[model samples]
Target: MKPHTIKYAFWGAAFGICFPLIATFFELWMSDVSLSIANVIHAHSTQPLLWIIDSAPFILGIVASFAGKKQDKLQELNTHQESIIREKTESLQKRNMILENEIELRKRISVELEAAKIEADSARQAEEKFLANMSHEIRTPLNGIVGFTRLMLDTEIDDQQQEYLQSVMRTSNHLVAIINDILELSKIKAGQIDFEMRPICSNEFFAGVMNTLILAGKDKGLSMNVSLHTSLPEAFIGDTTRLSQVLLNLINNAIKFTSKGSVTLSARMFDADFGTRLRLEVQDTGIGIPADKLESIFNDFQQAESSTTRLYGGTGLGLTISKKIIELLGGKIGVDSTLGEGSVFWVEIPCAACDRPESHAEVIRNQAEPKSLNAKILLAEDNEMNRLLAKSVFEKWTQDVEIDYAFNGKEAIEMLMEKDYDIILMDLQMPEMDGFTATRFIRTEMEAPKRDIPIIALTADVMSVERKKAFAVGMNRYITKPFKPEELISEICLCIERA
Candidate 1:
C-alpha cells in the first residue's frame, strides 16, 4: 500500500526468516539429541504446524509496525491541528483588542458630548436671565413714556401738541410691539405658552378681527371681503385668543402688503375624527411672495423679499409667532403665492363641536363695560408717572369709588393691614418685597378680608411663565403694564365683583 507499509512488510519477512535460524541455532546449542543446525530446522512435527509458526511471526511483526506508523501519523496530525488552533486564538485576541479600543473611544466621545450639552444648556439659561432683566428694565421706563403721553393726550391741548402726542403714542406702541414679539418668541422657544380652550363662533370671531383691522385695509385703498362656508359649525371648542392672534397676524400682513384690490377672509369646516377641522384663510391681492420664499417667510425675522423690510416697517416676527400659535393649537399654517399677483395664507385647526352657543365676547363685554363699582381699591405701583396714570384712569372709569395708592408691595401690604380694601392691584417687580412674596404673605400670613382679598398682577413682565408664577403665588388675575384704561377698569371691577 504505502512505501512505509511496504518497508514494514519487508522487515517483517526478514525478521520471520531470522527468528527461525536463530531459534534452530539456539535449539542445537541447548539440546542433547540435536547436534546439527539442519536437524533443528527440520525438527517440526507437522507441515501445518510449521506453516502456522512461520506465518504467526511475520503477521505479528507486520501488525506491530503498522500500529507504530499509525501512532506517528496521528501525532503529526495533532501537531498541525494545535498550530491552527494557536493561530486562530491569536487572530481572535487581535480583534478583541481593536474592539476594546473602539469602545473606550466611544465612551470618551459620549462623555465629551454630554459635557458640551451641559455647557450649552447653562449658556442658554444665562441668556434667558439676561433677556428677562432687560425686558423689565426697558418696559419700566417705557411705562412712564407711554403713560405720560396718554395723560397729555387726554388734557386740553393745541392741535399741533395733540398731534405730536399722538405720534409719540404711536411710536411707543410700535416699540412695545417689537418688545412683545421678542418676549413672545422667547416664550415659544422655552415652551412656556399655554392655550386656553373654549367655545368660539367663527363668524363673530372673523367680524371682530375684521373690525380691528379694517382701518388699515381702508388706508391702503383695499376692500375687505369675508366669505364663510355655510356648512361651517356655529360653535366649536378651540383656543379663541390664539386663533384671534393668528388671524390678526395674517390679516395685518395682508393689509400691510396690499396696495390695491381686496383682502379676503374665509373659513370652512371639514369632517374629522376629532369632530371638525376648521380651515381659515387670509387671501390678499398684494405684492405676492416668490414661490421659493413662501416657507421661509414664516421664519423669525424673515420676509418675502429683503427689500420688504425697508418698504414695510415691522419686526418680521408676526408670521413666526402666528405659526407657533397655530401649532400650539394643534394646527398647521401655510402660504401660497404668485410672485407678482397675490398671496393666500391658510391655517387648519382641529376642533370639537360644542352644543352651547358661542359666547366668548359676552363675558368680557359685560365685565368691561363702563360701570360704577363704588368700591374701595388700592393700586400698588413703584413708578410715579404710572401711578398718576392709573389714578386718573380709575377715577375717570369708576363713579364714587375711593382709590388709594402704594409705592411698592410692602406699602401695599401695610395699606391693606390698615384698611379694608376690596381689591389690590399688585405689581410684580417691586422693591423691598416683590409682588409674589407680598401676595404670599397676604394670603398665608394675613387674616380674614386681607388674606382672602383679590389681588390682580399689574406689571410690565408679560412673559407667560411670569404670569403663571404670579398666579401660583396667590395672584387672582394678571394684567400687563402700558395697558388700556378700560382694560384696567374692567380688571378692577371684575376682581372686586368676584371677591
Candidate 2:
C-alpha cells in the first residue's frame, strides 16, 4: 500500500523463501534423499513447520511499516520546533540593538547639557567682572566732580556761578544714581542682596524718606504729602533701607512725570497669621500709563511709551528694581491707572510687630552735625583727582586733622611700618598690590597694634563679592565712591572712636 511497506515486505518475502528452501535441502541430505526441485516441493508439502515459517514475511513487513511511520512523525515535530527557536532568537537580537542605541543617545544628550552649563557659568562670571571694572572707573571721576562742586558751593561765589555749579552737581548726581541702579540690578541677578530685619518706627521712617524727597517735589512746584493710618504699628521688623529705596523710586517717578499736581504716600496695616501686612501706596496726579502697558512697565528697561524715555531721560530700571526688591522681601507690587488722569502704585509686605521700639535719640544723633575728628589718617589711593578730593574734604571738615597719602597698597604698608597712624583708608583696586592682599598681610603677618589699627575700605567697586571679600580680609568698614562728604566724615569719626 505504501513505498516503505512494500520495500519491507519484499525483503521479508525473500528471506522467508530462502530459509525454507535451505532447510528442506538440509533435511533431504540428512535422510539420504536426492537433492532436487521435486524433492524440495514434496518436503515443503509434507512439513507443517515449513508452511508456518513461510507466513513470517507478512507479519515482519507490517511491523517494519509501523516503525517507519513513527520515525517520520518525530522528524516533522523537530523541524517545527527549530523554526520557532530561530524566529525568537532573531527578534531578541533586534530588540537588544534598539536598547543599545537609546542608551547611546541619552549619554550624548547628557554630555551636551553639561557642556552648555559650563559655558553659561563662564559667561556670567565674565559679565560680573566687566561690570565691576566699569563701576570703579565711572565712580572715580564722579567722586572728584561732586566733591569739588560741594567745596566750591561752600565758598563765596556769585549767584550766576553758584547756579551753574548747582546744575553741574545735579547732573553728576543723576549719573551716579543711574550707575547705582545698574549695579543694584546686577547684584539682584547674582543673588547677592541681603536684607536685615530690624525694628523700624513707621512714622519716623516715612518722615525721613519724605524729608529727602520733599525738596525735589517743591523744586518742581508740586505738592507732596504723607498720610499714615492710625492702625499702622509704631514699630515693626523690616529692611528700612530697601523699603526706602523702593519708595524713593516711586516718588521720584511721580515728580518727574507731573507738571502741576500733588503726590501722596499713604500707609495702613492689617492683621495676618504670620504677623502684620503693611500696604503702602503712592498716588500721583501725573501722566498715567495706558491700560495695555501697565503690566509691562515693571519689566527691566521697559517704559510705557518709547517717547517716555526721550522726554523723561531715565534708564527705565527703577520700577524693575523696585519689583525685585519687594518680591525678595515677601511682598507684591502692582499699579492701576487711567490713560490721562493719574495712577496709584501699591505694595504689600509681610512684617512682624516688634515689642522693642527703636531709640528716638539715635535718630536725633544721626541728624545732628558730624563730630570733628583730630587724628592722623593714612589714605591709599592711586588716582590723583581722588586724592585731591579727599584732601579737600578733610580740610573742610576740620583743621586739626592730619592726613597722609600713599599711591598704592605697598606704599601704605611701608608707611604703616614706619609711622604710627590712627586709621587707614584703603582702596580696593591698586597697582603692585590690592587692598585685600595688604589687609590680609596686616591682619596675619604684622604684629600687635599695627595689625589692630582700624582699616576702612574706600572703594568704587560695588559688586557684593568685592564687599564680602573686603570684610573677609579684616577691613573694619566699607564705603563706596561718589559718597557724600558728611557721610565719609561720620564714618571716620565712628571708626576712630571705636579704635
TM-scores of the candidates are 0.83, 0.81
Runs in model 1 with CA error above 4 Å? 1-95, 271-277, 327-331, 349-361, 364-375, 395-407
> lDDT of each model, Cα atoms only?
0.81, 0.87
lDDT of 2 at 498: 80
The alpha-carbon deviation from the true structure for residue 18 of candidate 1, after best TM-score superposition, in angstroms, is 12
lDDT by residue for model 1 (34-126), tens: 656457556544234455656756786788579657756776789799999999999989999989999999999999999998998888777
lDDT of 2 by residue, 355-407 (tens): 65846644211213323477899999999999999999888777777889998
